[model samples]
Target: MAHLEPLDPKVDSIRILTLLPRVDNPNSKELFCKLENRTLASKPKYEALSHAWGPGQATDTIFINGQKVVIRPRLHDALRSLQTGKGRSLWIDALCINMEDTKERNDHVNMMSYIYSRATKVLAYLGPSHSAFNKADMKEMGESYHYFSERNCQLISKSIYWTRRWTIQELIQAKEIRFHLGKGYFTLDNRFNSLSNASNGSWLDDHLERIENHRNNMHSHLQQLEVLLEMFKDLECEDTRDKIFSLLGVADDTAQELIEADYDVDYYQLYASLIDYHQSASPLQCRSDLFRSSTYDPEPWRENWQGFDVSIERSVRVIAFSNLVQKTLNSAVNQTPIPESLSLGDPIIARGVIIGSVMSIGETYDDYVSSWESNKKWKALLESTYKKDKDLAKWRENDAAFYQEMLKWDHSEVAAIQSCDTTKSYGYRESQDDEHITREALDSVTEGAQPRRFLGTKGLMGFLPPGAKEGDQICSFWEACFGVVVRKLSEDRWMIVGRATVSKESLTPAVTESVYHDALNYGTENTSYSSLLSRTGDEFWAKQKDLAYEALIFFKLDIPTLQKLTA
Candidate 1:
């Protein structure tokens, strides 16, 4: 067994494998490689591999510098598949970094963004079932990804490479990226325009759509931490905290990570650094105890405060301006510069009052995602509850017009709710020729419901995030379309469970307005933001009205144990 050679502590210095060419002799068929130290400043040309080393033991052996080095089968296969040209080099994590050295591995992990961006090319190795790209996989330059068969598309979605947390950063950071699979290799230069399938169905379809969404986000440069977190929530790494850390490199917030992260990627300085980065998007900022001064505007964010993510402040979800923040901004007053409030991990002062509390909870997002039958159960529960509730006429008397308008639309006839389970049914229809399940809008309250639903303390219907409790207070941020759940931590300390909805009615497919549209919705600002007064609900933004912002806003901030925010 050969131990990995450790490099000196030069910050920019890195390890690379200068793989020796094939040995033609029949006696030794084993793949062999020799290690060498290279610095990025020297302009080393190498193919950086973005791969997953599965949980399996390192049972497969490859000779390194005439010494045996055991690696997981996945890496061994990846190495065997490589055709290292003479004098060409490779930087694959499994072999290049000294995993046994905690300090070395930590340093390299922090340098991942720099390494991938500097690479001549990046190969996202799918698995051992490797195949070389040919004319069949490459059309002209790279139009082949646009023409993959519906079946092949399914197979691409099923690839295990998509499940790794680290791959997300690799995908975003790669100078030029290619996907390798068993049947072939291809690179997507543009959005996936599948020539065959129009129906977005099955888990496979969800995976494909997610890829498209990933492309769209990158295409549009929507790399905010909240957006990336929501986009890649399902992705996993060995340490759950790395789920957040792995993404920091690609997030718009972390343009310059000046501080060294903890080995776990969560330390006091690093946490404060992230908090600083999150606030980088805020036009409403204080003088930097870190980073440059800003002419950064909150204008673009204003339009889509709820549509996109505002940063997370401590345990509280900071989506919109607190009413007080708006009032301060509106009144043009000084905040006395509570700079330490956030960076030191103090609770952000939320200025809004409690709108409601959890009264009754309903189906989980996973519940609806489990099956069509499960969503139908969600529908049945809501309809029986919302439609028949006589108390709505009393408690929500001011919202009479909304209830009446909803009843007129429901017509007391079509008893079933439309499937708004976007993950499962996004862009799906019964037939392409005819609209049988006539593809409902993805933003439709039915298509992208919250992870859960709950009856509010006021008998209003709204969203229920994962940890909502019976007495959790649904509080408001300034400009968001939805309200968040704040469970009392103590006398004044509160924990934001997540964004919850509190509307006039339950998850009904019946309403035209988003506030009352059974599912929690956002980005629907009209001439008037959704007020305490329920309007007709018809004034949705014209084009992308049905596009759901399906980001899970609650992430356990992987910071050093800090004090919870105080009210």
Candidate 2:
């Protein structure tokens, strides 16, 4: 290791290994590589070897430039298999980059995309020996076997090399890639030419398929780095810092600008900075995570995180109705240097208008789905859904349109929905075929099924987050939507439960201002959604307006205070 030489960074030069011809004892598992610098301008004719180090074990000795070097046995086997009698030149990250030099590691790791893309060819080593996983094993079942055996599927899924984070960008940016799966190999040109068909990306690992598809469809709203971050957050990596570091090479140019690669920062700051970026630049929508993903992840890190189920997409989105967080989150971009003292577990403080307290929550998700899925007709489903609820459902049939449109509780205006009298607005929507409900309207009702129905104080009826409770405050947080469920943990301390949707609202413009006072209680201590809406008069408004003004002064001009968002 002491014989390692540094490359001149002026021309972006890097080291490549030339595998020496086998010795007289060809059967020996010996490897000797000539490591030397190759500049990009000189057009080095060498293939880059991409492989996982695999838990950093299995000691194997190899000679480099007449000096002995230790590497993983898999890598040693790759050199032996890939080498020829003449010689084979390749750029292997483990040997080429001087790990002893921190600055050199930073420089090379930062531009991994360029290194892999510029290579003559990229050889991805998945196994160590000639008996390593190969598609040729499938030939015994049949050349045209449609379904892959459970063993082959298990082998592919369980392969550490396939799931490693670095492997993603290496395969993506490569100009050409050849597989080194022991005796079996395949490329885009050929899926070992043994399978029936491998035209689409199905031939690759599931992780690669998911990421590559997202990359292809990235021109749409899914272009943000958050998508990739959320998608591959759980991938395997030796170093925790690599969770974020590994994605930078393949992220969009604009997304890449949000954060810089600095090996000095701990994983906490790195993850916190990603949180800062996701809050500010991500698409306008509200996310409710299955776990506390917005706050922490289950990755086995230095920090003992409560891990996830590792199977589900924790972050789910629904249409947003307010612009509460826009101006407040903009300041996130200006603060580039994430403070080292930033605590990941610290709860962020947010100031907003307390709209209402949740009064009641409907049946559990499983029950509701069981009932709704079985009932085909829209009218029958609505009738059966509210049979137990005495409040909204009692008068719902009399004014079905008002109930369905959620305009019944909007005491401010009954004319909010133009067609209140049209029967089409009830169980059915207006369309060319008025006899049957539009499929979109029927499906949209439970598409992002919050499952539990809830009525808020002040007669606001809507769905609550999965984690939300009956008494949690549904706040209209500045730069956020209407149904953000927050609970008071202590005086002036609140934790976000999740985002909910307005009863029947869609993606409308977020209101710039609200008359909702911070301290006003819309519902009383024991009574639910009733009694609160009845107390009405100009005198009440007159008093409430004075209180609203007082609340504004208390909150300091309604400009939201930003805090670390924790669940």
Report the number of the highest-TM-score candidate. 1
lDDT for each residue of candidate 1 in 375-395, tens digit (9 for 90 to 100): 576556555555666664554
lDDT score at residue 349, model 1, on the 0-100 scale: 23
How do the residues 1-567 of candidate 2 rate in per-residue lDDT, one tens digit apiece?
Answer: 565677776778988788998867978887887888878788888888888887668599888898888888778777777766888888888888887777888888888878987988888877743333354545432212233334454455455687687887787778777766553444643432422333333324456556556545544434345555556655666765565667777766434455666677654455455544443453321122322135422232213212321111111121111121121122232233546477444222233445667765665333433576532343353455455656545335433433445423332221111111111211100111223212121212333343355655444555555556667766554324344555554443344454555443321222213222211222122422224334455354455542342121111110111221211
**Clashing pairs in model 2?**
298-307, 323-479, 324-478, 324-479, 324-480, 325-478, 325-479, 325-480, 348-563, 348-564
Q: Which stretches of candidate 1 lie over 4 Å from their true place?
A: 25-29, 84-88, 130-148, 182-184, 189-221, 256-260, 264-276, 283-347, 351-353, 357-457, 460-567
The all-Cα superposition gives candidate 1 an RMSD in Å to the true structure of 15.8
